[model samples]
Target: MAGPLTSLKVLDFSTLLPGPYATMMLADMGAEVLRVEAPDRVDLTKVMPPFDGKISTAFSYLTRSKRTLALNLKQAEAVDKVKELVRDYDIVVEQFRPGVMDRLGIGYETLKAINPRLIYCAITGYGQTGPYRDRAGHDINYLSIAGVSSHCGRADSGPPPLGIQVADVAGGSHHAVMGILAAVIERQQTGAGQFVDISMTDAAFALNAMAGAASLAGGQEQQPESALLNGGSFYDYYQTRDQRWLSIGSLEPQFSARLCDTLGLSELKSLALSQKPEDQQRLKTALKDKVAEKTLVEWQEIFADQDACVEPVLTITEAAEHPQLKARGMVIEVDRGDGVMQRQIGNPIIFGVKT
Candidate 1:
């Protein structure tokens, strides 16, 4: 049985995280993805540590279910070959800086001329137009430019380095997938393809979500730890006796009451709903002290039966082996096409069974 995107074909020229990630999702959904890589281009993922049978572990998962082609676009013959592939591959994803693709003679307009139904998606840090269009940037630079990092960390400490690439994955890669799919849908109505410009900074700015809405419409600018959800209230992480972290999100009155009861600090329930700075500080202090009294496992056991939104922070390895994630089939084994099966993170999308 074919997957949902069985009819789609993708030609990916992007290296590293963003574009590869987008195409990976497409391949996971049954789209045939082919990578057109330069013969000498150095992709860090290919050489990164922890190799599984010569290739790096990350490259194995990112390139799962996708075929590869080495071609140097500097050669006219190679460019012609890509143009030939454009006639068959309707979707093209690239991460080159602005004008680089045009200089290579394989830009969106060039390909669209050959195939009017080509959905060309360009993923960049600052987009196709703007002052920083050609600027070099990474995940943190985009987040900082987009103001996402402004309110993420503690006020005193400033923005701490995040463990994950929020702008690359959440902004660039995710938006490219969405834009390509949307163009595919619109093509059905208009019988034409369109250029999808996905800027990591632009998408990161959009990620402000509730905070952006409030600031744009209500004239309320949120600073670090100034918002209710960003550690302004008692709904934050607490350190346990064993130095492990536990996230507490008992915002609702019911959950707050339950949390306080579970901690034997039911008297602090009134302070939970109060937005007063002093009240919030008081509640936070109480939670910190109580949480420090026991280890993470001890608190997990005590709150196992409670409905309070309290959960211990588990390491990535612990999360992989957890019963809930195991039950959800979040861990899957991908065939490496060499009789060897490689374990990789499974796609999160759940689709209805085909009748």
Candidate 2:
């Protein structure tokens, strides 16, 4: 039995999270992905920390099920090899800044000329055309420019730096996968390949839909932590007695009522949607005082059978072992050769049609 993309062939010249992640998804779906690495510039993740003596855990996890092809694209012979290889591969993914690949003689136009059916994808920070295309940027810069960091943090404090690379993975990686797959479908009908230009910042801008509706469409900027989902309502996280945190997302009237009743704060339920600063503070303070009265474990026990959407905020290790996550098989053990098994995050999508 084979996965959905078993017959697809992908030649990946991308490194790091965004491009690698896109091709990794294809590889996981059973595509034959060949990671094309420059002879002089190996992927930095190959030497990143948390290693198994010599092998990098990060690189191992990302490059799994994919073959590697080292080539010096700077040389004419190497560029010719790539042009030849593109004729056989169905897809090509690259993550260089604008013009880098074009200078290498293996740009989209050159490859498409060789292989008309090749789906070429280019992932960059700003994109290939704009004024900032040549500018250097990472996830933080992309998020900041994309307007995602504007309403990210607390109202009192400035935007707290994100723990994850939202722009890299959510914006670039996910969108690259989407654009490539859409191109794949289109190619089936037209029998022609196309270029997929992915900009991290551009992709991240779409994630501002909720806040964008209020700001862009309504002509009023949403203040940080002043919106329903941004911590304006009574739905937020509170500190427990043991210093652990508990998240409460009882947004609906029924759920709010349940939470209020469970906490013996029935009088405050009516103020759930209050926009008044004082009322919001009073309700938040009351809930905080109540939550701080018990440990996270105690709160978890109290809400175990409740529909209040109240749950303890567990650490990464705790989350990995959590009952719900374990039951759903979100964490899986992958054998990394020589009987060495490492726990990796499982794929979320469950296809109905098994190969």
Candidate 3:
């Protein structure tokens, strides 16, 4: 509890990944987060199997360093208890559908009235308004609706299902944390807190990033495997002879030159940045063939000292054991509240302060 946000307190009323993940990050940075869960509610993370001692392994990972309380919000006493807690826990995070909190008599307006300086953040799928506001959606649905699926994966195969929950963690969780922190800064100046609206879909829609810029202003509708970075050029992944994937990101002329020369196909260096579809495809074919000739290990040894940005696509276990990641302290063991210690991925944020 020695990080930058040590003085901050949070009351978490979120169920699944987005809200819970946000609170986890806040707790990691030394915020005092009190998780208020309904005793009868079935949190997937709590009952999804793979137990760590007495608690769910996923639950153990997500709820680390946070105090927990169970309350049935249907009871007036529970609502009053929450209202009482709000006096000190000035920041509130809830993931219920819009109006559900209002109906429960513990919404932002109600709590904000008690503490005019309360920072309330609401995270939902579509948002507090719009036709899809009340409609349910998962990470894939949000990403699909946001046009992220349009230009990912092979054009013939459509978009591949990603292992990660891009919308939930990246879109909802990250954005909620950013919004809450921004609101905190604003409150410092105004001496009054405000509500933060975080819609997973809205947030995912904005993650299109440079591709979106192209479509909106350049009037270029990006297609699957059609863009420079996506998979159109040699910047994509190539399968090694052992079926292991190698990511070739030799985008710059210097890097691609090094890549072409090191692979003994220096003649292709001129075509590395070719915009013509035929030449780009040809260059890709040659690089793919050359890379496929070697096993992942063989290629790794060849490029061990190369600055070509070529690297092996590692599994999670391999990644955890990688020298660079190990040096960066990306994995650690933490107590699971039951005093049972387990290894989990460490937070990626590099904080200068000890926590």
TM-scores for all candidates: the values are 0.97, 0.96, 0.97
The digit string of per-residue lDDT tens for model 1 on 134-215 reads 9999999999999898888998999989998899999999999999999999998998999999999999999999999998
Q: Model 1: what TM-score?
A: 0.97
Name the 10 consecutive residues with the lowest summed lDDT in model 3. 346-355
lDDT of 2 at 105: 95
Candidate 1 — worst ten consecutive residues by lDDT sum?
346-355
What C-alpha RMSD separates each model from the true structure?
1.6, 1.8, 1.5
Give the per-residue lDDT digits (tens) of candidate 3, residues 221-291: 89988989889888999999999999999999999999999999899888997888888899999988998
The order of the candidates by TM-score, greatest first, is 3, 1, 2
Write down the lDDT of every candidate, Cα atoms only.
0.92, 0.89, 0.92
TM-score of 2: 0.96
Candidate 3 local distance difference test against the native:
0.92
- Local error of candidate 3 at residue 21 (angstroms): 0.5
Q: What number of backbone clashes does candidate 2 have, counting pairs of residues 3 or more apart or in separate chains?
A: 0
lDDT of 2 by residue, 1-355 (tens): 1578898899999998899988988888888999989889868888888887577877877887789989999999999899889889999999999889999999999999999999999999999898999999999999999888888789789787888899999999999989999999999999999999999999999889878888988887887878888787677899999999999999788998999999999999888766786787789899999999999999999999999889888888899999888877788777655478878777666678433
Best-to-worst lDDT order: 3, 1, 2
Report residue 32 deviation for candidate 1 (angstroms).
0.4
